[model samples]
Target chain A: RAEAKLIDGKAIAADVREEVRVGVAQMKEKIGKVPGLAVVLVGERKDSQTYVNAKKKACAEAGIDSFGTDLPGDATEEEVLKVVADYNADPNVHGILVQLPMPDHIDEERVLGAISYEKDVDGFHPLNTGRLAQRGREPLFVPCTPRGCIELLERSGIEIAGKEAVVVGRSNVVGIPAAMLLQRRDATVTIVHSRTPNSEEIVRRADIVIAACGRMEMVKGSWLKPGAAVIDVGINAKDDPSKKLGYRLVGDADFESCKEVAGAITPVPGGVGPMTIAILLKNTMEGAMRAYGMM
Target chain B: RAEAKLIDGKAIAADVREEVRVGVAQMKEKIGKVPGLAVVLVGERKDSQTYVNAKKKACAEAGIDSFGTDLPGDATEEEVLKVVADYNADPNVHGILVQLPMPDHIDEERVLGAISYEKDVDGFHPLNTGRLAQRGREPLFVPCTPRGCIELLERSGIEIAGKEAVVVGRSNVVGIPAAMLLQRRDATVTIVHSRTPNSEEIVRRADIVIAACGRMEMVKGSWLKPGAAVIDVGINAKDDPSKKLGYRLVGDADFESCKEVAGAITPVPGGVGPMTIAILLKNTMEGAMRAYGMM
Candidate 1:
């Protein structure tokens, strides 16, 4: 088999961000206001903050207005709900997202579900979920992570139709919708999760493997088809004694061996990671357009 | 390997119907109205009418009120939408199902989307689909065939959690949601469709194989994991010269050979067939209860 090309997710995501920047600028001029996204963070979890900062930075580069509400770790559920409720009714706030895994005391479901479906930029709203599952209807916002994965593939010129695609996870946020989106694109998809006894062997036969299992090194090179494209969605924190921070991020798949066998592959840190923020910005702009009936 | 047990879907569905019958009677007395399902047939297609008749018959035996609207073949999209709108507004109608493969003239997407998500008893509503896809939030109604497949397995005392389940086919109405439902029950799930080249080999490793490919005898006994439970959801009309209807219905798997290798297997016509309508009634009752806040 011929060697596979390395898929540059970072470059693709950068291009997407540039496109979003243009779209937002056009919409702002036509509509007399820029698309606005409001993100609420309940606590100062370092990772969540980094994600939020990246999202805000992306929004800025895309010419979309971004707002953030950071509450103390001890904030009550009602405190977060109040912020969400305020955004839900704001005409200027076209999209709203409450960063996940809030403090233990806050009821995450109540707060997340509180966001109106139309402004659910995070795509966690049941309404958006419904939209993804319904055959012909388009989701107001496909969840960013899954959407990013597909965007990476499409932007990379991978043909999904009639391909054997295996997704190694069943996460509602990523795996489930990723499978749905891939299947919608005509890929014959197989979703193998924790319950799968011989997941490695199963994945080895796929033409395309999407490893979003979140377990570091769960998918190795031997588990992939010789020329298969690999998209690793996991961003796991692994202990690295040599690092100044004492840890580093690694994907679910072992990249070293996988790159040797995979025909095309998305590297961790620089791969699917960047595309997620890009898609979030895109979804926000799309949400604004959809709300204005331009969709 | 030891001989497999053949699961009798006919008897299982019959048992389910009886349970629904009891529930329907109780619901009627408690709510002052029997659960009602309105099936809209947009044309004179014979196959559709047969399905409509079957559903109506099941509703009657279960003591649920049923209504049908059979429009002409040339009916406009608005005309069909009118029926759906009427059913949506009718307090008496607890569930609404528009027969599939509507005539060419009607815009099926617009018409299907027109049905109020609340009365979408077939669970085709995007909202319901989304609800079903979410982790903890259950749908108001799960689509019949998928729900039926799971119910059949559960009632027969089969263990779903921690089992390896392979679903053949990935249709929106059946394969996709069936896998999701199985995952909800803690089954490790994999979906294989037409594009799956090594489907038979994959099937042989599964503890539970759900065949919904709609192809007669495509899966053979060799594909079975010895002692695995098989759920055949395919209802294909094949050339059976001996049958009076000019053909006989068979499942995706070769039942005769499958029964020899499978621990339990449901036959084509008798297996998942009866369970489909049974689950429809169950969904309607559940929908009624949800709407009435009884659940």
Candidate 2:
């Protein structure tokens, strides 16, 4: 069998960002202000800072106005909610995201719930989650990662309806929503996670396998169905002395072996990594459109 | 191998109903009104009538007041909503259930949503559904069948946490919520449904398998893990010439064969059948408790 073709998520993400840029431009011309995203980052986690920076950069690149608020580790939950409330009242800030893993003293749910559903760009609100899960109801914004995964597949012209799709994670963030989205497209979707014994056997029968569990190299080439499409959502840092950071980004699937048997596969670092920011930009643009009744 | 034990759901349900009777008696004394359920049956479908009668009988035996509204085949959507509004306002009625598969003319969602979340005994309301799915949020009522499945296992002394659970259906009512309930209990849950190509292989690895796809005998004995616990949620009507009705209720599993392999298994008609009403009664009591601030 020929080696599987690589699914270039980075390239597709760039195209998506370009489309979002145009959409934002159009919305700004009609609505008097560019779409704005307010990102609230608490504490000083390096990874969180990196993600926040990337998001702000993407907004600027898309010509969408962006705002950031950083609070020290000692900041109270009330202070964070204050920032959220401020954005909720600001018509200019169409999207709001609170960086994850808030300080230990904070009531995460209450703070997350404080954001208006219209401004919940992360799509973590129970209302949006419900809309996505239920039939016939449409979520105002699909979560970025799941939306990005589906966008990549749609751009590839892969048929989703009635296909055997396997999602190898069950995280509230990715796996559950991903399965729901796939089912919406009419694919038979199964979710397998750490507790799933014989997961390899299950994955082998799928025409589409999505690896989102953060276990590096858990899914091997032998687990792939011949010509199956693989979407790797894991971004684990593996020790690599050769790198300046002394670490390398690896996906849930072993790229070396899986690419040989899979019809198409995504690479870590360059795969799902790029699409997240692009979808965030898309969501921001859509938020602007919806705020103006353009959807 | 030792012959697996058969979990007699008929006996289990009887016990559950008896327990609910005591609870209802206590509530009636304290609240001055017996917990009441309003069952809205749409159309003249015989199977629906049978199910409604079963629910009513169970409610009666448990000392819960029951009322039925059987609309004709030609009832308008507004007609259903009117009854829902009536129940919503009725102080005595603690639970309201609209039988599933309403006629094609009626907008099902609008009808279901018409019932107030407080009176949504069937737990189909989007608010309740969202509550159930959200991590920290708990619904006032859980859908009956899934709750029944869990109640049966727990009453049988089957441990769920840290077990490998495989759910063989992904329906909104049964499979999905069941998986969520199990996951909340710390079970490693995998949902395998129509999209799962090698479901048998996946099922064989599960410490517990829940069959809810409503397909008769779809799960073979070979699909069961050695000494696994099995709960069959399917209620398929199969031809039975010996029966007066010319049909019999069979579960999603091949019971005889599965009993040989499974450590514990619930029978088709007796397994999950009785527990659904039991849980419904339980939910009504809880709803009343909440409404009265006694919980």
Most accurate candidate by TM-score: 1
lDDT of 1 by residue, B90-181 (tens): 98889999999998877776776688988888887766777788776767778899999998888888999888889998778998789889
Model 1, C-alpha of A118: deviation from truth (Å):
4.9
Docking class of 2: acceptable
For candidate 2, the lDDT comes to 0.86
Please give, for residues A86-128, the per-residue lDDT of candidate 1 as tens digits.
9998988999999888988987767767899889988888767
For every candidate, how close is chain A to the native chain A in TM-score?
0.94, 0.97
All candidates: DockQ: 0.48, 0.31
lDDT of candidate 1 at residue B22, scale 0 to 100: 93
User: Model 1's CAPRI class?
Assistant: acceptable
Against the reference, the lDDT scores of all candidates come to 0.85, 0.86
